[model samples]
Target: MEYITLNNGVKMPIVGTGTNTYGKVNNDYNGALTNEIPELESALELGYRSIDAAIMYRNEHLVGRVLAESTVPREELFITTKVPASEEYVSSKDATRAAIDNSLKNFQTDYLDLFLIHFPIENKEHLKNTWEVFEEYYEAGKLKAIGVSNFEKHHLDELKEFAKVKPAVNQIQINLKQPNKELLAICKEEGITPVAWGPMKAEDHQKEVLNEIGKAYNKTGAQVLLRYQIERGVVVIPKSHNPDNQRANLDLFDFELTTADVEKIENL
Candidate 1:
């Protein structure tokens, strides 16, 4: 697997597994809840070195269980989590620090490869405050890098006016179906790597591109889609509870997508 370097000098895996697939951690929207989060041990055994979860996911303890039993060393894995959005979209520095501590204890890891503010909240001060606290943690050795998720370009520009530390990464909803071109350009220009989530859902771009591309290489639609993203310098986290799917998610190393193929896929 290939890796990307964060602005802070930490190596982040290009592909990871997301834990919140069709499930609500502890909260229900309006009146509905969903399936239980998947077992992490299955994911770890399937060759996933990175696990992405959030406090809202409420699966930290479950993730911890797998980490303790896995054969992979702590240094070889990358774990990314986020701080929950409280009232007014603001967070306390001390509280954020405490949250990091709680995360370390929950995941049973010595440190985190990445920590991001989950969502854009109300006050800009609170957002900057959260980053400041993360910066402290990064210096103190609890987190290797810090970033934001789902941030619009305007939100990022607003933060840049006074941000002490620039984000090392920005996780967003990106795919051939819902590509946000402007935000992507801003991230690339600002030196923040963009991570693409929800790539294989039915709602994603049709498999015609994948199928056509696969014809040239004899690969699956999923493999073609992931390779396309990584070729564009975007990180991806495609999740699956099935063993074959999980292994397929990591099988992008065997083939290379051609420039014309990439352009053809991008054009469609």
Candidate 2:
């Protein structure tokens, strides 16, 4: 797997496995345990070192179970989880503290490789206070790095003004349809690593374009899309239940895209 160095000098895998699911099916952590455990183990067996999870995803316990049983050493794995997106948690320092502690308990680990604000709250004071809490945890060794997800330029601007430590990452949706060029530029300017969540959108036209591009490299549409993001210095967490697809996501290092091909995809 390839790696990107965050502003804090920590190495993050460029590709990770995402664990978001629709509906409340994940509420039964025990029932859903069967659903993700094998797949996560399969991902690890296929050489995935990073696991992207969140409390809102409602499967941290399941993800934790995989980690608890994995043969891979803890030091070799990079685990990330997010705070709850609700206003109650996003606006309260005590609530945020309880949330992170719960995540730690759920993950069965003392320190998270990375933790991020799931989303930006409208209240600047609340957001800044929450970030300050993250900084405290970071200093206390409960979190290695702190960041935000789904933050726009205005949101980042506000955070930067009062932030003692700038966010290390900004997780957002990026795909062929929405390249998010402007947001990426802002992240680049602020020394934040851009992480693409939906790297492959599966749109018919987009897939066709990606396939056409992949034809030149003897790869698939998904592979081409992931390669495009990696070429642009964006970390991607492309999720797939299929082992073949999971393997393909990580098979981007063997080929390189020329400037022309990169621009072609960017223009799409």
RMSD in Å for all candidates: 3.1, 2.5
How close to the true structure is residue 162 of candidate 2, measured as C-alpha lDDT? 86
**How many steric clashes does model 1 contain?**
0
Q: What's the number of clashes in each of the models?
A: 0, 0
Residue 100, model 2: lDDT of 92
Best by lDDT: 2
Off by over 4 Å in 1: 22-39, 201-205
Off by over 4 Å in 2: 22-36
In model 1, how large is the Cα lDDT of residue 148?
A: 88
lDDT of 2 by residue, 1-268 (tens): 7899999999999999987751224434233334445668788999999999998877788788888889999888899999866776876889889989999998899999999998877887788778999999999998999998999999998888888988999999988777788999989988899999888876798788889989989999889888888988999998877788889988999999989888877777
> For residue 191, what is the lDDT in candidate 2?
89
